[model samples]
Target chain A: MPRTALILFAHGARDPEWAEPMRRVCAAVREQAPELRVELAFLESIKPDLRACVESLIAECWERILVVPMFIARGGHLKRDVPLLLEELRQRHPQTCFELAPAIGEAEPIVQAMARHALALASR
Target chain B: MPRTALILFAHGARDPEWAEPMRRVCAAVREQAPELRVELAFLESIKPDLRACVESLIAECWERILVVPMFIARGGHLKRDVPLLLEELRQRHPQTCFELAPAIGEAEPIVQAMARHALALASR
Candidate 1:
């Protein structure tokens, strides 16, 4: 059976603090899907760009990979940069199957998570 | 005459990288509201918590203050802890008026921002 992998992509931050939440979110996803291999990548200002991340998965011989954008909205990065990158990767790695998930901000879980955060604040 | 102040609140991150975006967002808001005094605060994992941020505004004698959560969602922090803090501050500083705005994630500008980021990514 081919191995499945998940890549959590975030906007690269020069400050480093913004990336922590992406780790937390990836951890949560891993906890939910222990069998799936998950990794993190940044668009800029960080190492392991999306292309490298995807190439690494291909080298690992993973037959399927899910790329999840940790961004909140479908901004320019998602609409333009990400798709362009994916297309480039797709052309380069025709054997690998890559599925792109919607940005995390559009996810229902985030709304629930935000509500939970708000409730926690209210309680304190 | 009453003065207006904008308080940009973010989830406190021990990592520090996450906070940079909050600062950027605050800067953008300040640019838009140059006449308004703007400040930054966190819910946890940082100094000058929300209460201190608000108290300082009161000390400055601002007649009205707007607190905007830089959080991505309406999580527990927004629903619970923030309101509790505001209530406590209200009780302590009855002379100062406060209005809490919705979390930044819900704002249309953010959606537009994300889309711009995505487009940028795609173009590259």
Candidate 2:
């Protein structure tokens, strides 16, 4: 089986604390899928951007890289900027299988969870 | 009884479709809690920014406006920019209570949901 890696791609921010939730989600995924390799990468204002992260993972002989966007929705960044970056990465590494998942927040299950959480917060 | 409103606050994007999930969440919230007034507001590149949303809600006799940030985490935008905007709203409407909820993504339940969703997506 080809070694597969899961990368949690997020829109980074200047505040270091901004990545806390992303890190937590990464940790949770790692815990859930102990057999798989998981990591987090950012778009800007942070270190180890998607390109750099992908390069290192490929260096470790990971044949497949799955990028799961942590964005709240399909904004311009996700629609335009991310695809551009991914295309560049794809061109640079033709052998690697680079897969992109839909933005997690745009998923129906996540939307329903957010709605429930909002109601729970307001009810308190 | 004082009329209370629920405002789903989000970081707006240029693409109108970026708000589709937000609208879905807002509609879900309204469906779950039909008695409460629910709406969506943006920080930029969209109509009815937070200030305008609050103003219109107040006009409709909503004495309390609960702003549930749809942000993924506590970034600089949430820590600094949102607080400044909320402060201005506070000064503008002393009678109306403006309650700012934590970013929905930062909440534990939402994080778990995202983690589960990510794992599911990768598993597929």
iRMS (Å) per candidate: 11.0, 0.9
TM-score of 1: 0.53
Model 2, stretches more than 4 Å misplaced?
Answer: none
| TM-score of candidate 2 chain A against the true chain A | 0.93
DockQ, all candidates in order: 0.06, 0.85
lDDT of 1 at A77: 72
Please provide, for model 1 over B3-57, each residue's C-alpha lDDT reduced to its tens digit, 9 standing for 90 to 100.
7777767767565554545555555555554666778888778767888888888
> Which structure among the candidates has the greatest TM-score?
2
On residues B53-111, what C-alpha lDDT tens digit does candidate 2 reach at each position?
88999899788789999989987777888888888988978998888888888999989
Predicted structure 1: lDDT: 0.66
